[model samples]
Target chain A: MVPLLEFRNVAVDAAGSEPIEGVSFAIAAGENAVFFGVEGSGLKTVAPLVLGLEEPSGGDVLHRGGTIRGLDYLERLRYKNAIGYLHGDYGLISSLTVEQNISLRLEYYSEYLPEEITAITERLMAELRIIDKRTARPVQLTRSEIFRTAYARAVVHDPELLIIEFAFVDQSPLNIRSFMDVLKARGADPAKSVIFMTYEPQKFVDFADTFIMLYNGRIVFSGSRQDFFDSDNPYLVQYRSTSLRGPMAIS
Target chain B: MMDDERKTTPSGGSVAAYVGAPLLRVWRGTVDFAAYVVSIVLSFRSLRFIRLRSISATILTQTRFTGIDALPFVIVIAVLVGGVVIIQGMTNLPRFGIEGYFSNLMVIIIARELGPLVTALIVITRSGTAIATEIATQKWSREILALEIAGIDPRLYIVIPRIVAFSLSIFSLIIFFDTAAFLGGYLISLATLYMPVGAFFGNLSQAFSMKDLLATIVKSMMFGVLIPLISYYYGMMPRSKSEIPIYVSRAVSRTLFTIIVLNVLVSALLYFSWLE
Candidate 1:
């Protein structure tokens, strides 16, 4: 099957920083790929780029085989509807109530008046198990509640490709499964692709179909999860040495 | 020797990397601000419903921003200025033995120049800067982008309301300032100068003219539009993720500069158009 998204020779540079140079990666229609990198690495750039918030300095980001560029409002809206982004920090609004926040993505597609918004938000609130906090703002919610609310907002529209950053925990396998189950319940297609960026490999190792390693803004490895686990190449050795988990897990 | 060379090379590389990117970002920000303005105009036509919704919200929300919140400072400044003007007019008039000219001078200067200009200046410093900072922070947070992503144009939603609200606020403050200054002048005349009430009232009416009134309104309206536009332009211009904080200062400087230039132009126009 054709890839849902492709980042061809993706090169990004931010103000006061060197270019995150020459990175290439793709996510097929039904794959979940996670980028494992050390702290302060350039993986954060991928989250905003995928969401179309920042135009790449030197690269083509193809959505469904067409170069993502110069789309009119309706077409751009269509693309955004299919893609859900949770960019760690740039993902949620704090002043709006939980219901208002969750309904933000859905408000574009549907002509939701106050009543309609309230009804749909109430449903999502219940499903996410934060119903009592419907009127409460994001600042009032705990960190985990904020993440869950952000996740609820991302999936409330039922996006096909879900991109997450700084999520998943190495110490909580059951929690990871529970979270994936919640996503599945929310109509996130088991066949739809997911790209998560983080430092912890074991956190996402069970859920990810492919593992891509980024070092110094360069992709040093791209392969199946098993190949990543099984590789003893010098780059992989170096990654293992730096990782919190010194020994790679065999599935 | 190799170690020394390695440290120097990395340090130099870091410095070059840091300096090079921001200069390019400033160029990018200029281009981006232009594109945003153009896109705003285009999208204004395309998204009427969203614009209407935002406009209504802006009208309702800005009552506080423009009216009630701005009241106290507007009154205080106008009153203090009126007192200063009367005291000076009284002092200077006695020297010329034309003490009666004090009320005429007070009404003409306050209505023609001081009232509208002072009101606009206060609103620009207090509310205009706040509006710019608010919009800039919204840009930084991706709230503005969220509106765009949702097919809603931000200019109508964000900037137009501010323009309208600021216009209303400045106009109202000018009206209030004119009233306060008159009262202030009257109170001073009665308490200090022992000027008769009927004479003061007669002088105030004689000094008032249709041209002076029109000039004041036009200048105030121009200022209302100028403050918000300059603030929004500078606030929304910076795209660099790091330079977001600099937007506040840039907004202030740009607004102040634009307002001063506009004030000079309006004053020249008033002098040429009305006096001649």
Candidate 2:
């Protein structure tokens, strides 16, 4: 079967001097892949480029085997209608309430009125298990709560591919595991094409069907979780031990 | 995929190499201003109701963003200016025993030129900066794209209300400022020089024609559009994040300078054309 997504020698110059170079990868439908990289390694840039928010200085982002430009705005919207992208910072609308934010995608895509929105809101609230905090805004929520709400909004339309930037705050191993289980139960398939980006591998190594390590803007390693773990590679060891304090922590 | 496609920036694209950028920016700014005018003009048709959204946004922006918030400052400036001008005229004119000329100077120059000019400058500093900064932040945050992705146009949702709001607000403030200035002149004339209230009003009414009032309103309205348009134009003009604040400052400064220069030019033209 054809891969759901593919990247070929995707070099990009987001800033003139810093070029993200020589990257090629692919993920089949229902295959979960994670990019292990430090900050400024170009992993974060990939999703924005794929989402068509940024233009690549070189290389095309192909969706369903066609270059992104092949589809017009409305057409692209239709394609993205079923794709969920959870940006690293949880890109929540601060002005909107939790329920309103969750239903924002529905309202934007479907133009659902009050009653229809309420119906979707109820279903999504129940699915995400955050029905009690539906009235809270993004600023009012804890990091974990924000994650759940962002995840719920991302999947509200039942997207085929869920692109999540794996984020963990000051949570214990148990809380992290519980949240992972909740995410898995809510429909994130580890074997599917759910391109996840993270700095910490121990928290997400089990979830990756394939691990692609990006270092200094290049894909340095691509292998199974066991191969990545068992290898005594110095780079992998260094990457595995690093912690992600989250986007806001970055200067 | 996007990867195999080679790309290169055009050669000699340095800031200095792009000498025509300023000209291009001016042309683009003019085109933008004209487009707004055309849209406003064509808004009479049923197909143009969408334009009304922009109009409504501009009106609302001018009201909330420009007018009501600016009242205190405008009043203080106008009053002080009026008192100063009257005091200067009263003191100096008495030397020639032509103290009556104070009313004439107060009525014509204050009502016609100083009133609108000062008010516009105040707005360009306050509301104008606010609008530019807000738009600049929106551009930086990718919230602009968020609006576009959500199928909402940023110009209508963000810009139009401000244009409308500043226009009405500026005009309203100009009128208020001129009225306050007149009151200030009267108080100075009454308490110090013992000029009667009726005499001051009579001289003001005689010197200030319906044409003067109409022309003043027109000039203030023009200024309302000019300042916001310049601010919006320059603020939205830059593509790079680093250049946005620079452009906003340039827009505000240029707008204030234009208000002063245009005030002089229009006043001179009006004076020569009418008083001749």
Candidate 3:
């Protein structure tokens, strides 16, 4: 299968220093991949490459075999419309209400019919349990509610690939779990792909069909969840341990 | 991925290089800012515009703040300015017993100068702060990047509506201010002195040239664009919350300075070419 997104030996100079060195990874269609690492491990830095917002210093970022960096203006717009990205802080537009914020993607791209827009709004609000808070602005929402709002906005278009960052940190675990479950279910459809990134992965580990672990700018593991859990790799072992003092955490 | 892309900065030990570094930085910044403003202007070339529905929604929302909410302040200032001009005229012109000339003098001062200048300042104080703070907050929050990722150009959704709204609002306010000031001055005259309203009207009618009206409007519209664009430029500069307030302060001061400089320059040109 052609992967939905692939990074080929990508070396990125993050903040004037090369923190992502020769990292290679591929996420095929329908695979919900989780990437986690300690600070400076470069997991959070991967989204910009896939989003075509950044170009790799050394290697290519490809979307279904075509170079992401090569796509022109209109093409890039279309490509981005088909993919959804959720930042660590739930990148909601402050000026827009919760519903306007969610519908913004559809309305901005000029893609939805009035009724289709109404239907999608209803469905996402119901699913995300934000029906009551639809008119409330981003500032009015609680932390958990904002998570739901961000989730609704990201998936409002049924995007082909969704890149989510900090999916579980500071979130109510139940809410994160439910959101992850929905994403996992969506990922079972052959047309969709998910790349989830986080600093703390243990709480949301159950959502990963495939797991990729980064250690000091290099991918130490990229494979099935079963394989990752079974491995006795020092880094994996340290990461899996729940103890306060572990090599997985920054010293 | 972007981090890999490199930028070369100029640095050297030679005497010329030592003197030129700051100058070089300023030159580069000027070019970059010109390019940014031009790019924003170019985005309006209809062929490149985003959905009209999006633009329409944005324009309406922007007008609410720049026009509707600004009406009260515009009115108060207009009335006060008009009264001040008449008060000055009433006290001074009666020595020559040419108090009838108050209408003509008020027309010149209020329409040709004060109308556009005051309107621009009010907008800079009100809409300019809001726009600068809004964009700066958005930039600080990474919401602009979020918009880009969502397939919306921030210029399309953010900047263009403001430019159009400010221009339209200032033009309207200039007309409104002129009307209010005239009526305000006339009311003051009626209360203070037994002047004939018809004669007052006749004097103003005689003095009201299309050139002065045109100059007032052109300045207001130009100022409308300048104020918002300056605010946006400064507002979009900072990446962190700590830097946003500083940018907001800088946006207001720089916007005021630019408006004053441009107002004088344009007025001088108009004086030479038309108003003289």
- The candidate scoring highest on lDDT is 3
- Expressed as tens digits, the lDDT of each residue in A1-251 for candidate 2 is 66677777777886643357777877777777778777777777777666666676767677667777667546776667646776546656665678977876565446556587788778777765678888898789877677777777777776777777655545455534545765665345533356777776666666677888776778877888887888756566666655343222233
Which of 2 and 3 is the better model by lDDT? 3
Off by over 4 Å in 2: A1-4, A13-31, A38-41, A70-84, A89-110, A114-162, A166-186, A189-193, A205-210, A215-251, B1-62, B86-107, B132-157, B184-188, B193-251, B262-276
Ranking by DockQ: 3, 1, 2
Clashing pairs in 3: A55-B1
Give the alpha carbon lDDT tens digit for every residue of B94-185 in model 3: 89998767777787688888888898989999989999899988887788888878878787678778888888998898889988888787
Instruction: Please report how far candidate 2 places residue A93 from its true position, in Å.
Output: 5.8
Q: If you assessed candidate 3 against the hidden native complex, which CAPRI class would it receive?
A: medium
lDDT of 3 at A19: 72
Model 1, span A1-251: residue lDDT tens: 55788899988887744356787877887778888766545677776777776778888888888777777766776788788766555445554678767876455345667676668777776776788888888778766676677777766766778887775432244433444667654334565777888876756666678888776777777778788778886567767667445433222
| Candidate 1: Cα lDDT at B78 | 86
Worst 10 residues of 2 chain A by lDDT: A242-251
Candidate 1 lDDT by residue in tens digits, B183-218:
876686556666667877787888777777777778
Rank order (by TM-score, best first): 3, 1, 2
| C-alpha lDDT (0 to 100) for residue A148 of candidate 1 | 71
